[model samples]
Target: MADLWVGNVDDNTSDDEIREFLIKYGFPSFDEIERYSGTGTRPAVMLIFHDTTPDALRGLQSRIHNMFWKDRTIVVQVMPERDES
Candidate 1:
């Protein structure tokens, strides 16, 4: 599995909009999404891909990292694997 962190997203953007944006950039549909609005400063979303690998996500990360979307310069990163134990 893989986790992707997408930051600097607009507050008005909906989940479906995010899904579409990622799909438009060649990302497979994510299995889950967790939204974070920390301090209402940098709204972000963590996307979980059940069947994808970190390396695969990393390869696709560059396609959208630092790209302007919804009036914000979004940041995309493939998170490091977490220890399940």
Candidate 2:
């Protein structure tokens, strides 16, 4: 599994919109998504890919990182693998 953190998203952007954006950039459909309204300043989302690898996500991360989307400059990062012991 892998987790991708997408920050600086527009508050009005819906989850489905984000999904479509990722798919348009060659990303596979994420398994799940979690939204965070951090300080109400920069909204973010954590997308979980159940069958994807961190390396794979990292490769795709740059496609959208620092890219302008929905009138916001987006930040994309592939989270480190968690130690699920």
TM-score of each: 0.96, 0.96
Candidate 2 has an lDDT of: 0.93
Q: Compared to the true structure, candidate 1 yields what TM-score?
A: 0.96
Pairs in steric clash, model 1: none
- Each model's lDDT: 0.93, 0.93
Ten residues in sequence with the least summed lDDT for candidate 2 = 9-18
Runs in model 1 lying further than 4 Å from the true structure: none
In candidate 2, stretches whose alpha carbon ends up further than 4 angstroms from where it belongs are: none
